[model samples]
Target: MYPFNCSQSTTTTCNASLYHATSLGRHDSTRQIATYYSVNETQLHPITGIHNRQDYLVTVPCSCGTVSGTTAYFHAVNYAVQQGDTFSDVSAEVYSGQVWVVGDEKQRFVAGNNVTMNLVCGCLDGKGTEEEEGEVIVTYTVEDGDTLAASLSRVVGLNELLTQNPGFIDVGWVLYVLKGSQVGCGDFEKGYFDAEGPVRYNIEEIEEATNNFDESKKIGEGGYAKVFFGILRGQEVAVKMMRSNKSKEFYAELKVLCKVHHINVVELLGYASGDDHVFLVYEYVRNGSLSDHLHDPLLRGYQPLSWSARTQIAVDAAKGIEYIHDHTKTRYVHRDIKSTNILLDDCLRAKVADFGLAKLVERSNDDELIATRLVGTPGYLPPESVKELQVTSKTDVFAFGVLLGELITGKRALVRDNKEPGRLKSLITTVSASSTHLRITLKNMDILCIKMVQPVSDLVRNLSGSSLEDQFRNWHASSLFSSYPI
Candidate 1:
């Protein structure tokens, strides 16, 4: 955990109160206190400079005797460590007895650098002894797209979590999370979204807006949330009314969507929560989900997307995933990257929706595999998800590869046709069952229905390969140059 300065020692006073933190100027030490979860520093590093000093504020709990308390520190010492000094070396030189240094060795203390040793108030974890909140079982249901780190971060700020649950966290494996105000919805509300006010809407206002949840007004349905088409304040809106019993997914998605904003992402306009009902209001896209346009033939008022249109849809959807993957302030993996999750606008623009299954990863550091229960749609699940329950951005990439096949072939990821006597075959299964000759498959199946161009054919060949990374890169690149004469 990163250290923060406490200007005054709690040795004199301890009272139950929220901790107050102040930013100490940055040091030449390669490490930073920004990752200290108590503070909201989502970006990897904005303090990478050799000549400038940055300020970082961190909050930590203070304990006084047997009661919870906090203290103010006005004269905290900030040490400017030279090249030869380590945290241990500095702690021994600066503080008197029983001072423990808490920084990584990889970060060398540079000359002319300043570092603050946060005075440890009696036992940070409530108890007077050194024992931290060891383990208190809190049943957090794994949301649709949650990775272990994101889930843990939700329960406890990232700093304490590293100390409590040090290694890989799995989905659906009930684990213990930190309890109390420090790691609850109250903390997230105060620290994360203090700037945005009144997220919660009135249930009565929503009911009147949606005509008392009229059947006709219902735009979409799912296990966790039912989407309604509503007009709020004279603009079209999609209101997601979550199952009152399952507030976990509601909070999970809201937490993520609140931080994320993009044209290609469904906007979370507002929300309402009460004892009996909870609702999320979003910007309503006139066209339905990609699934409705692509596969639901009975639906009216829409023409089948032309090859160019479909290609554009693919590009837009890819951009949404790219935003979630790498472009966002913090990288997120959309575990459920499938057609239904991709919604369409009136102008045929695609927006990625349903953040219920997304997980957060460090920007440019997504290769770390998170092991969890297999939870994505069957046909869209990657090989690693099924075989080892491991998840990464490539898992989304694999699912996107399936979505690409869905777009190109105009077929469901898994389906059964009476003409084919066998059971349901996934798109991958059909591709694999086809003969080694790519030309024969194209000639017979006429998948995509375009002239057999070299680039398109090569893309089809790439689908059969093992690397989802290569496949998505190839397809994303192809989507850029694709031209189909309709």
Candidate 2:
């Protein structure tokens, strides 16, 4: 058993009048000061060698005119230490199902606060065994004051915890184990671990299936992680395994993806987590990304995508981006929207993927703006994003404009042939220049004359009265192409 104590320095002022109500006889107008227990560990337990459980005693001071009138209540002390975990991990275990007790008028006891109380050891043991692979496996028991990190440390190797659990063991997994342990001896049975259907591959099984992350099997690499093609349950799947255990962005991405239930968005098949790895499984799109079709010269000639097909692709991509911004409960700003990230299905439908840079904003608050590190591909990024280092849905709109320009002009965003100086420009510039020539072509083609001089005579008739005629006459006198019709 762990030794315990109470420190007077840690005491809080309480309502003396409340304690007097519980006592017999007369009531006192003076404030009551309650005495509570606190504990300090001097050494480890002799038998278990674990410096775990601590108990505290809380005494209510009351003037009952007798020694028996004064009573002390015993309560267990609870506290928490940070063990690097996702928010979900901490919330489910540490805060769930804990009851708060009312103390003096000025004070209250919370679950996270360190407390002292008396409780018997082994009061909650229900350890059993299961036959797995013809061998008996003993159930893991979490005694009082057992933390997930400590419990997993006692049973499995420490390296296994780091290697198998990407995030550190926090209250969330512990609460899950506690709740599951009360029900049965198996793992926590949630949607991801259902038994009605075929069993999905665990982290170990997925690693084995991918040939221990062979470089030859690598399909794609991104800022946060890598993609690999793998077979699971005899079905082809694309597995995006995260690169680091410390990425909060990866967890954010997973949270957003799991909540999104759109047909246009890529579906999440399954996920696996180990100490060093976090894997997201998705359905494989055989045709690959939109960037491959747009930029690859070898692919362009085989099947020339018509203008109508390109316009449809633009509309499909816009709908996906719009869905993230408007349809979701919280508005999502996909900071990174580029051709490469827009995946193409076999039927040529575009699905937006790679939400690692996405951010959720409040609906009611217009004043709220998020300022973080600048992230996105160059040339495709909007001017506001580049200058202000701010990202909003409007930023995505500007990027969409760039994508539309690419679709219309059939040219890359930055790449242009330098030899043909005035030959190529942006879609906006080309359209503006073409409009002038189109008007001239329409005028010259509209008036067909019997002789070449009659064309100039018709041009002079059209422009004889306007102010433009004076400028044309002045320009014609100095120009070498004066014979050519305007």
Candidate 3:
């Protein structure tokens, strides 16, 4: 993974030290600021990262020239207008937000100006040519009735096109399409523009598909969302309904899903957003999460996974994490890695899901640890995550190791109120005490493994002591654990 280096800034008063650290990994980087600025500002930059230049570069006259910070004053002002403020109203309070235009002499927005600025979409500018680098570019020719904006709308967001290519109007000109990077249209684009983003399903369509969100269709629920089985356009899908459309997790998941595409990662088909609720559409996996299969006795219709199937599930999940960390344009850390988030397909193949806590990191020095908020499920969290909020891909690896233990022992990570002394002891803490301890646990697992191969009653009647244990110990020493890095 690459390292991220943060740019430094100094204020005139006391030389305010902006502790700039290189991008540790995807888990540390944020999307609040546009890429036009530093990879991601961590200094005096706001929590959302986008702010006016005057606020930070007070002593400077031209914020554009102030290379100390890649301050985009217009972005905050843009957001103000997008939130329903008029030109006059926004300009009046622009200075308070420390916003200003670089070339404008008056240092204020001209009143009643429509063409001067795109009030509709303040921060989401342009067709994102750089953003669409890996996308397959296709061509579209303007029809007789189509305007330039209309022509481009068929391929990309009109506002984004206007931002990317200003004054693009030709009746018959050819336009390029960046396969799947279009923005959504709704109240979000009330009077501004229109285009397709990832699939957008109407609320009614979602309701109808899920039988009006019938309880029977409800598959799973989480801290911030719920998953329901649905059929849209004749294709089965899993619709994840969020508490609201504006939460940080919704945007985080959307941003991560927009960039990732791999068989091992759950495919995001499209989404629906509104003031009250947001729904994410994903390719449905018929079998439930790996946790349910491994630990839920009430889970119906499915037999226990074979030993080979368990190993394959781990391998598939590892590939998904590998793609996120190494193959993305930048490194990504799946902060919440657990059996619950690993779903099994009809063929019992595993695919990683739930990227609400995923982080985008840029490679700079090495895969340095960066500070972030501590957020993840209980037993799966690593020591650094719980102690200091310092995390790297190694954090996910630690969680994966715990998951592997669950698969091997056929036990949950945390066993509550068990006969065991430590009621909530994590599987890793228990079995990973030492190599000898792990070997002993594997030896007991050998008996469980044999039950799958031979009837337990017959094995008890016919088996000799230490024979099966010896065979498994030999295999475990040479074949099983040897093949795994853990």
Q: Candidates' lDDT values, in order? A: 0.52, 0.44, 0.52
lDDT of model 3, residue 3: 9
Per-residue lDDT tens digits of candidate 1, residues 162-256?
Answer: 34664444332222233331222211221121123225668888988899899999988986788998888786788888778878778778877
Poorest lDDT segment (10 consecutive residues) of candidate 3? 10-19
Alpha-carbon runs more than 4 Å astray in model 1: 1-198, 363-366, 369-371, 417-422, 432-486
Clashes of each: 7, 14, 13
Tens-digit lDDT track of model 2 for 438-457: 22422452211111122222
Give the candidates in order of TM-score, highest first.
3, 1, 2
The better candidate by TM-score, 1 or 3, is: 3
Candidate 3 regions off by >4 Å?
Answer: 1-197, 366-372, 416-422, 434-486
Residue 440 error, candidate 1, Å: 16
lDDT (10s digit) by residue, model 3, range 41-112 = 211222111121112111100111122233321211124124344544433332221223234423433344
